[model samples]
Target: MASVKPWSLVLVVFCIMSLSYFVNGAGSNEGLGASFIFGDSLVDAGNNNYLQTLSRANIPPNGIDFKASGGQPTGRYTNGRTIGDIVGEELGVPSYAVPYLAPNSTGKAILYGVNYASGGGGIMNATGRIFVNRLGLDIQIDYFNNTRKQFDKLLGPSKAKDYISKRSIFSITIGANDFLNNYLLPVLSVGARISESPDAFIDDMINHLRNQLTRLYQLDARKFVIGNVGPIGCIPYQKTLNQLNENECVDLANKLAMQYNRRLKELLSELNGKLQGAIVVHANVYDLVMELITNYTKYGFTTASKACCGNGGQFAGIIPCGPTSSLCKDREKHVFWDPYHPSEAANVIIARQLLSGSTKYISPVNLKQLRNL
Candidate 1:
């Protein structure tokens, strides 16, 4: 070929690289396969098999709504995808991986990130012990560490560590179970140790949660997408229990949720400030979910007041909405898939808002703007 001018060569390179980024949305990375997640049923793909918690979705009706599963839903609490899955969609990451419990698809640890997020887990010890097999936050971190070693064996420490710290997305979504399963269930605060002092309990739990998170930051985690607790008051099951209460969710629980969020915000701020070169982003599921609850009319959700599963009074919310279970004809019209979870369609809407370009809530700097940061 004839010698090309230097400016012409530079233009060619710029055009080619721009196509890879704008069209592909996949950025330069150390080869991050997926977003590794840890926490509760909010994001659990199939890791509850590792925990002894009653807060589980490894059952029928749970996965029946997941369209991506080809009409076979996994044990996700939502009808289709959790916030994590949709978040993965926004981040250009694959659906959160169940690397810890699922058998290797191709006998490789190179699948997207592993999800150790078991349903019913919490910051408190013995939180999800009701299940025969479960994993707490500590064990989840241990899983990440073990996976690091395994990947190191496959690709060596330098490459493996780079993949985690630079390329991979790290997300954590837990804590609702701490209040729902432990403190607020049965509509009574009796027999619950946390009930001894709910306020103190929240402070302690947030502190413990922060410690676990700080540990993750220490372990080569820099690009963090930390999820705050969603609205606990508006779950269909809870509403059923408090039907007489003028649409008011339990005050104590909601107060504590807000308190916990405040603490977590403070904690993340401190963390970002302390750690150099850290990109800590808080996914505010709190208001993102509450908007669906308060503004259901604006969103075209007909039955934000009722879950689409089962029958009868508040009892149906507790009962799983399955194949035999009563379901609304139009799922897109309902905000909640079951009592405590959002429908797949609702999740998509929330995901869209979260990734909306006008606001930068998911990250202090959205991925689109992260390059300058």
Candidate 2:
């Protein structure tokens, strides 16, 4: 795998979202039952509510687009649910509640893990540097460790080991906002460029990420499903501000992401090799998302270029698309649910691909190899 053409992220020539191409979904949760997630908004389910940051979504218009239409207490970016929410239900669990930040009512509720992903978090502890209070990745893990300590006290070592060993599924989706908000934006004030070259920057970034995850593994986290970055350049938000000016993806950003994913595959393979019975998986969001952009006509998208809400401008991607802002007549016919996020309809399709296997991207072993472990 040399350099990935922005168009062909999946194995097929043009990586469109057919869902029909991969036939072996519904198998990822084969033995695993519950999920514990920690990252950023991509997998966040309301953890930011407890934190003090302006990057909050627990307001009006946020949940308006969801299937529950605000009935759901979920703080996901989507109108209704995220892939995490769907997968939780699929695993016969309730909403994957935010751990530590979200309170557990009973002693036995620790059976399934909770989500600790803050909206602006990253692999480094660099999230929310602009705001007063935010949990960086290291602190988030610290919170997770502390909570696990509590669970250990309550459940006792034997049952805690049982829960950790048997049905615990760990999902981590992060890194996009690390570049966007912390590094790219002019206002965050911390403009520390890891390096000038995209390749070097990504290597440094994900390498830093691997060390943190390795610490988690040593602490008893067994199963891991790491999400690959989506086509950040194609996002209406990025396309509006950065892409159109250059008339292409912010190649620096896109290239870094591609390199990150490419390197991530090799890193994950080696991790699986070193850690027996532990799994490392990738969700090729780059291809799943391109379907919403280039092949909009085929995917029933009426407007792939603009978000459904607000002016469809550079800022629209920042908030939810609803009454206070602009609203598309139909959502199923569109791709992005928000300027920064995907639709409920889109997530279901992406979830299908991830469950199939990590391959079509990862080289030697597919997800089946990890699951068999």
Candidate 3:
């Protein structure tokens, strides 16, 4: 060949590099993989919208801040993105994991993983009966099992197994409702409290969770990030319902949460040790949330104890966020969106920590580390 001109040679190299970039999907989220989320309203996308239950958030102001739905409610309890949604976005997940009950959850949608969480879901079968309908952990797993079968049909058995075990993260943010709606209800929980001590109830929860995690492992789930119960006593609802001071939280509720959290940490440690090739990481939601509530100013929050959308006393937390609820003009300044859920701003802070925080918040490894593994 004749001597190649310098400009022509440079152009050829640039074309080759551009082709490689497109082929490898570099700088793009091509291989971050799917996320299978399991939990209650905290992580629920829109499963409750399809269910006939008292615990539904498909009305206005619920998703007023969720950009995915163009500010329309998508059955999420919060005003915007949940922790799960934020984590997925930060991890470069291409899209939100479609809710299992959504009409579009079939076909190619299932390949991106599925969210099986419901508004009132819990660990025990009878945990949220007051809601009339909710998918407990057992039922969610059953739904996952069915999803796994669908995966087999779509990608064949071996490839589907590999996809699920290697290219997915099983995130569970449950347990709060088991305490909030089950063991803490005054009239409804009287029978349970009398029949079982707090220790006994926690033991039951642990046992059920053990089986639930084991079941997921058997179904080829190798990565898990289990968020321990947060400081539920500090929620706007708890504060308002009990007439607590701005700085005070319900001691009994916090005590129960800490107790269960301790056991849950131990249980996760056990699972990590016992299960081969499994990485069961713990996300310290309690400390993270408590930090936000205690140092709200540091986190750019104006009010940590009040709900941005509700109708009631000081906290505006007795009533859930609805059409006639008192909507706050400064939504992002409030730590909570309603009585029980965190605002999208608070969620962003928590998600950043979980994604790249130190071992103090996410033990063993943070979400970014786990994703790489």
Question: Which candidate number maximizes lDDT?
Answer: 3
Report clashes for each candidate as comma-separated counts. Answer: 12, 4, 0
**What TM-score does model 1 achieve against the real structure?**
0.83
Candidate 2's displacement at residue 193, Å, is: 3.0
**lDDT digits (tens) for residues 37-147 of candidate 1:** 888777788766444556567666666667778656677876678867776666655445654777762224344667788877777765655554567788888778777
Number of the candidate with higher lDDT, 2 or 3: 3
Error of 3 at 358 (Å): 0.5
TM-score-based ranking: 3, 1, 2
Query: Least accurate stretch of 10 residues (summed lDDT) in model 3?
Result: 21-30
Segments of candidate 3 deviating more than 4 angstroms:
1-31
* Candidate 1 lowest-lDDT run of ten: 22-31
Local distance difference test, each candidate: 0.70, 0.65, 0.92
lDDT of 2: 0.65
Candidate 2's C-alpha runs over 4 A off are 1-31, 65-73, 187-191, 194-200, 243-248, 312-315, 318-323, 361-373
Lowest lDDT block of 10, candidate 2: 18-27
lDDT of 1 at 46: 71
